[model samples]
Target: MKDDKKTDKPLKRQETEKTQQLAEHTADSTGELMNTNHGVRINDDQNSLKAGERGSSLLEDFILREKITHFDHERIPERVVHARGSGAHGVFKAYKSMSGVTRAHFLSDESLETPVFVRFSTVAGSRGSTDLARDVRGFAVKFYTQEGNFDLVGNNMPVFFIQDAIKFPDLVHAVKPEPDNEMPQAASAHDTFWDFISLMPESAHMIMWLMSDRAIPRSYRMMEGFGVHTFRFVNAEGVSNFVKFHWKPLLGVHSVAWDEAQNISGKDPDYHRRDLWDAIESGNFPEWELGVQIVPEEDEFKFDFDLLDSTKIIPEELVPVQRIGKLTLNRNPDNFFAETEQSAFHIGHVVPGIDFTNDPLLQGRLFSYTDTQLIRLGGPNFQEIPINRPIVPVHNNQRDGYMRQTINRGKSSYNPNSLGNGYPLQAKASEGGFTSYPERIDAKKIRARSRSFFDHFSQAQLFYNSQSDPERNHMIDAFSFELGKVQSVEVRQRMLGILSLVDKGLAAAVAFALRIPVPQDPELPVNHSIPADGNLADYDPFTVDTALKASAALSMANTVKDTIKTRKIAFLAADGVDEKSLTTVKAALEGAGAIVEIISPRLNFILSEGDEQIPVNHSLLTAASVFYDAVYVPGGTNSVATIEAEADAVHFLNEAFKHCKAIAADLGAAQVLEATYFSKKIPSEFSDQTVLREGIVVGEDPKKLADQLILAISQHRFWEREKPRKVPA
Candidate 1:
């Protein structure tokens, strides 16, 4: 077994030729002349060949025709779901062999670094939707292993909104823009969505996740990912074990406040996308630990909830995750359209040792993915796309489809043809050929769900009870915000009843906000997707009380908050700034992997105490506090006066404080803080405990202020101040 504590290094491409092969398609047009699609050097690309100076373009102008035609066909059909996305190239290396659990080469070979491409996306958004939508985020990873490509198609949340795939269409349609007017794009806060959700009790657990801080992640690098279905791992001995995959980010889970998320959407709609690209380019590679919870087949039914139920999770307390591998995303895609957009992921894509279970959701996705790809990618040969191609050589009888790139020379394409002498013979099991697990199954053909999958409210309660006070409050506020947008009073009342099942306090809170009474007994057997012939008694969901009430793993407040790496901090200053104080704090922050940018009242440069010109990253007019993780104000007689006078500068501090972000100011710059709305709430004295509790650091000494600021920033936020004191930006 490889050493678990060994530091992971960047993957070297010298071990495989696949990375180099992709380079051939990568184009850099630096210092290059414009050319046509045929690579013909063009000297007059600015203007098309015209009859005289002002006439219609000639039909003979192949350049114009080719350019226009290519441009017209550039866009392919966006995905029905997860339409907006960002992708990156990376490598996955196992920490130790997992031969006992499975025979998968990538998991059993510690030395091999498998190439991978991962795409992060919003589930219900369009190609142009905001990244801050309060919706589920898809976290799909495609591993280009020598055995073949394995796609772990998953989401940021461990559970999903629906148990069966049949309800997927209805769920999406309800959350998407209303069909009549197409209003409320990329949001679930609408009448249709609440109406659908209020009737679907299976969505209770997932709705808690959506309304929690998990829905609006701070960045893609700081979120936990999970394969929402239970899969099977087959060993060399033909032994099978049920598995649930997880990706625990190294940076830990974090999120922005709902109000801050709204502001960020307006300030930078591509916030997460830009952050990912910037992090990779700046050498701050994002990483995650690939973990798995393995349960013996005999122990599957030991859980209160069914393993096959997509809306439930095998809590970590019951089955702890064994993190056996590290996945590092070190390279950004060369082209968004050619790589990120073209990449295809399906849960059915698996290597030897990895196989599917009888999960109804997983079984349906196997058919849905292939069918969706056929229409969206324009053919069955979409795997031939450069981004989706496997590293291993593919040999098959299938050939000739739309946009087919392979050229075959054979007399027979059939499997049992003597003319070709069975040249493309299939490999035996010993030769790494995939063999499905030989599990016996004897069941009558039926459309009804299993009785074991009926429990829905237990895990939902567990998730709610597990959250920290701040997280719980945020969830309560989120429910209020979403249900408030709902137009139907009946839908709101029904949802409040569902909330009552999870927690009465949560239900009453949302009811108070919505100005509606929480019904003593709203309704039962709220499932609307049941078969017409099905008896309501058989379909009634059970409320199994789990042995463990609260799982620490369910709370984001318990996540790692010891590092401030890659955090962006803004230094508010202007003309005649204190150079000593500004540079001292900047050096300390940058030394700790924190990015420090100078923001002044004007663009270009700011004048220091010695009349030295100091460059500024952005002016207060263009930059907002929403774009940064924290705010710092350096002392300067003229700088502090200018910032105090500037309304935008004062608003920046106020907004940052209102968002519960860390704020630090020099003693000299206290006047500037006093101008902000939250200044009166600032404590009279500053201490280490006060700095941590309040998330505000102020000191006369630059070094001391910097030290306190670092500590405060690591805490991520001081949400305690949000409810007690609200500021208007």
Candidate 2:
């Protein structure tokens, strides 16, 4: 069989042309003369046409009016949520045919490459907000398949904050900046958010995720994405099964420390965005394994949690994900607004095999996405936008809306008309036309939730129990920090009460930090969002003691830690640095797929021991330890002394140590290590085991040090060092 892998084959012209259509609207004026919007050459663009040099501009100056009018109306309405986002172009290919499970062409065809556009974003943040906000990330992917566009609109976390779509608005309103003051932008550490969360027990499971390390991702390329809701996959025979989507990054899931995340937000507000753009630009394409947890329709009720509940997750232990395909993002968008910003994703955009379940939240989004695009993208016809257009031809009776790019020529615009001879007729299911699963329903309409969704604290407890020691500590610290920011005593106390349901120790830790007594007997049957006519006793959440105490998959500590690809390593050096030690280590890291940057006392160039000018990528004044994944100090007689004397260099190493990042130095640079605040905490011997455990290496052999540093960086971070040997950088 011919190989269908994108890496093995050249990009097809059709795919290039699809993207090029948008490129035609783009222009670069590097060597071109200035011209008006109409392409007319301008003799005096700097000065508008006027009666005199300083006199009022003439009203007849079409150039001036056109320029100002275009500038004035350049902005579009940003997304109400997930306003800050970065997108990339890519292709998805199935590893093998999934025809037995689903009839979706993209999933069943192994030879086809489906064009895709993925947008990574942070929820609760506006277009101008910082990317490091501790919140859920929007991981929506638009797959332009032969059948149509299938949008797997998801979030980084597997669950949401609410069970039903009815509470979505209330959840967003509370998490957003207070309407009165509009304060605490892109943050959920305020009283309003906690007040709402404390009242709604259904949000407990999602809150655990929000407070965990997953909320603060190191980079968009290093995080995981989930479809959040349980969808349905129907085979050609009309057999249906429950399915959940997952995107597991090939780079492994990793995250920055909460403190480091805050520092990054201040240092570079566009940290995640820049990281993704730079990775693709440098040819380190980000890739993810598409996985699905398929649950037989009959077995869905076997789980303790409700499959329809958006706030629960079917643990990996219960249903292991089957890795069936790959999604590679190889190209960055050319224009941010034209492509990335204008892109629209809808949960309802499913093809033949892919169908929706009765998930309340998913049902609500089916209506919300199209309604939002109607106003946000300017009327209805948003799918016609180049970035959003499907690969297949779109032919329908509907036409002529705002921003109508297609000029249709037909005598009849409606169906059942002989004037056009039924030209744009619909296709049958056998002909690749979509057909919704004929799900039977026989029940009275009511405003209520299933009794199965009443047990909300079980998964929350499982999540807390599954975390590693260091992860648990981080969660405690996170809850403490967030609650400490809450000004309302009532909200803080109530949140502590809610936390107690998940874990008593976690609640006690936050209570101690807040200097408030934990409420011994807080409100039971807590669900303030229950319907007005509903029975409070029946609506109260029940804490189920799940058979599984913990699932290792819930913790990031168990994530892949075998490669350091795309990791940024900063080489600390100075004038008269040992050229051999610097060059050898730099080569080893670069060869390992790690990006190496030279940092010295000053930018431009630094003289090495051989008197060769080594270019510096960043200076001590401009670079921060938080910007790199690891730190290395090369050796030199004068270089060690100069770096030792530089307080910023000493603090750089110390800060890296504080954040549990790998730190390496040549034996000759002992003086430099000794100058740092963390030097005294280093172990006496540098054994192979100790080096890996401590994430600190000091040796004479350049090659050995470089190899050990590569292994240390692959571990991501030495989180074990955070609490035991905490230091003041």
Candidate 3:
């Protein structure tokens, strides 16, 4: 049999040194004889050794015992957070040399190519949880550079819910299902969550993000990533600068509507994982540009909010992101268990140039990552695993741990020994060895929260104000829905107080939805992140109104909408569909890199008006509007009549209309659309502009209709259409 993976490709992906190294450890069982773990040939594999054909299996059968033992101990411990994940192999190429900023080999050389393994996951969900949960997405990338492995472990949202790592456990427990009931899985709509959030005013900024559309990203490829905590980049001359990393998707940021996301969760729980795998398998590689916001060491204290505060972000208006490199995910993992699952990423895995900052959350994660891996991967020698090993040869004094793959031949395991003649001696900084930056520190030993981290509401207000009208409305609805699910009325009322601090109008909107009165003046000490002494004066938080009112970068309305590349467009049709009308628009969309699938009343084939047997991708009963970016209907007498009468087909159109997806139809097939719930609200006009106005296109010319549909779909969604009323399906 031919190897499809080796031959099937449109782009000629260049192999890096790391890729070749991985191939050395990769095992291929093709054309090989089956054998035991000890390489013994097994002839009778199907049946275990028995006394008399049906007798009890013998314990002396090594083959059966070996197989059972391996199977029983196969699965490893999943991550406490980000358990449900999808990974891909790729390469990163720097746009230009950045010798002035740092001495990291990957960033200093423009021509150098570094192999990368990236894992995307949803936080606060179990391994079996649905991918459409409204939560933060983990965006981690491990760069196998020539020097060593550098991991950028971050998330889709730039800021986190807590400022310090000590509160990480409390935050996770609150977001998780209740301890007694475990009623809700993969959701934060519970009393425990609101009860915690109501008192933690420090989580204000991150709460705005969690409630926004960013939490429900359209797909992994369309999401943006950011290094939540600020880090330091020390140059060759030991000049340190504060930096924030960002991964900006080329396809642009987009998300599914809340209702549509719920429907998708029910229809396809593996939506994100499947989307990433299929895109790579079909050669439609996803791409993102590596951006960075660099601030000089002297400018760290220039911002109103603290740089060490993980809950706040350095707004784009204050510091612009510079696109420094391009990261392209071109290959899916060969084995999910061996590659994706075992691909360990940690923020502390930095090369020579990169170093940590004083971010408290970051400092705690530095210790937690190694500890977590020791248990999750079975031993301290987990780095020896093929997926986690660095491309360069490792020369360390440590040895003899569980799952250790290396065989040290020397007599000396300790440093500065004459037995091995110091064969693996450490090198100096001049010889490409890492050296810690000389940062002077003279501080107290007492445990106390930084006063600089107190002004949390400034950025929260900034984020709330930065949203577009539709986005802001969606946030209000989300807050209302989540709060309404809480059983404790006090928790809901207390949360309204937190929301009121961010924006009184937002609180009023949510109060209207929940049929609860807005808090006129809530009790004091809304922040519960205080010491047991209850001395509020010493740790009281003060609010700061930022100079900038809104940031365009904070809103998805400003994201890229120029291309419909890799967008899924559903073509609704059935028997007697107009061949010309369907093919004309389908071809135009496909030519622009859109994936068009035909949905009909029946599966397999649909007869066109010209008696042509067109292939149908999915049937009306099996397919869903939640899976597609837009919907289009072709003209044909029987097709329109049949679609209008079929309950499933009409319901599909209704759901598509309700979800704010672009809907287009040929004038002859307009009757099919008119049979839907939102037909009365549909505009009578037909033009390219109307596509943008109402997200509905109806015209006689197939070419014009196709053009309008393309424009409408490029917008991702017509959020303006759902402003007035929701179409009941």
Candidate 4:
């Protein structure tokens, strides 16, 4: 007969001997009931302490007061950087067991579902800041894995503004509105920011991203997320791979134009937050695929740029990402203050099989995240907050601080104690304990960067070259507008000099737009040289190749495309409208998870067939086409005639067309489109035009209309139309 051991399941057989033995040693035998701080056995907690007369409250009620006091003071400090944000409860599931890559429990177990809390935010904005600001969006996730809570504190942009951690404070201060007047809130379109950018050459690449469409995302659900720093994924065999984390939105990356974004800020301050909350409430959960581009340790130095630099990205074309898991956000926070506000995410938090590198910016973050929490969250016990607390039981010698929740029952609260039988001792390295990889380190304590960290202009030039023709034009316009805002001519000239280093054509274009002379050459360097405090020689910026070709990954237009599930479409109608066209179009659009709003002369119920009616979501005075992805005018002879007479409706279609948004109309609605002189000056053509050729769609068939509208929305904007309009961007 076959051996019984050979026939049994591997894990089941092994658990009978090894896992059962371990569990027996760790299990607690006694059954117990949960109690309050006073350890009272009495029930009845729905009411507070009171006197028998019911007119006066009792003072000597310890249990009631204790419970109320604890509840009242439960809130802690919010994050200083990403103060205003929204979070969702989600589950992360691995696509397949990654045993071949890392030993991380979540990654190696496809069957396991790891609970996660993800927070998305806009930097340089206060808690009351508008949602549609042109700033970097923070994409932080806290994964409550079996081993520990792992926090991936990241941003929507892959590259950062500065290279070293020491410059982080300066970068933040400069990018934020000027300290003197604080004129601009949650924006980088100020003189101080441009001045800082002109001086700091390392910020060139990031500036390209900030000025692009990535900054003004339509919704938090549409933007991509990235872990900006290089991390290490180690296996059980002690082998490690350098990885960069990326979260690709299943809805696809999309954004509004600058003008549209500004208008959205004025109309709906809580645009992104409201969109996410409503989506969750409607059961249309947002999801993203967690991907990683891992480079084997031995192949680290093979790339042209240093992996240690945070201001650069190793293009996916070079090392394509391997998507290993997916994160689905299914629930919104129960309480904004209790969950979203008090949630803490630290970059230092990591589980076994995941580790940090000596990346200078990342090293600085490890210290900064923890240090900020102490001041902002009120105390070191911030982790004790329910939202930040791990699911696993925490036991250590460290104890006693402000808001300490756990009560130690044993006599010995310290480790290496005979009284408590040395319980809660630190686990050894072999038994699922976190141990740093044995990387050798030998360096002097010098306040200097490596030679490899220099040469900041090459990537900047590469980004400019990578852009499609229209994107490059937008960059030029951004520089012109930003420099024009600078009152100081010297600052503008200095900025032109910086642009010359990036691209001569770019500098010349900006100078022309501003009606100023382009600098003949960049100013001479004040400091002759600085040396690297290492075996490697100092980097020479002059020698570095400034002619490196464009990388496609640097361009947002080159990103993944084609899903319009979360796109917003506005239906323009009024009382006594065409019920058939409105119902058919809206139903088709919303069925695909698209949002449809009926915008009319007022926010009252508009009558449909059989006295039935649909509530007008927004009035003409309240809603603008800038707030939506597309606009449609249904067949309503009287409704279209009334709306066309109003200035707001005319302005709405003009703005939508100017931004290159898709617009559809039936036979009766065509009169409104033709009468509204929104884009009258815009020259139209079949393939392309000096205005929105893709914007106007007049038809009878619903399917054809839907296909055309989706195509126009995907194009993002009709920059071709912008040229003739002479709107100065």
- For model 1, residues 1-729, the per-residue Cα lDDT tens digits are 112211132235422546776776678999999898888998887899999999987999999899999999989999999999999999999999898989887788788798899999999989999999998999999988767899999999999988888888998899989999998999999999999998998899999999999999999999999999999988889999999999999988999999999989998999999999999999999999999999999998898889999999999999999999999999998889989999989888999999998888888899999999998999999998888888766889999999998899988999888999987887777778889998899999977888898877899999999999999999999999999999888899999988988899999999999999999985876666688887887766647866899999999988999889999999999998999989999999999989999998889999998899999999888899998999999988999999999989989999999999999988888778778889788755443323535888878888888888998999898889989899887
Clashing pairs in 3: none
The C-alpha stretches of model 2 lying farther than 4 A from their native spots are 1-14, 24-35, 38-41, 684-693
Off by over 4 Å in 4: 1-78, 526-543, 546-548, 608-612, 679-692, 725-729
Q: What is the lDDT of residue 529 in candidate 4?
A: 28
Pick by TM-score: 1 or 4, better one:
1
Evaluate all candidate structures by whole-model CA lDDT and list the values in order: 0.89, 0.89, 0.88, 0.77
Give per-residue CA lDDT, model 3, range 291-363, as digits (tens): 9999999998998888889998888989999999999999999899999899888889998889998899999
Q: Return the TM-score for each candidate structure.
A: 0.96, 0.96, 0.96, 0.86
Candidate 3's TM-score: 0.96
Model 2, CA-based lDDT: 0.89
How far out, in Å, is residue 675 in model 4?
Answer: 1.7
* Structural RMSD, model 3: 4.2
Looking at model 1, residue 358 earns an lDDT score of 86
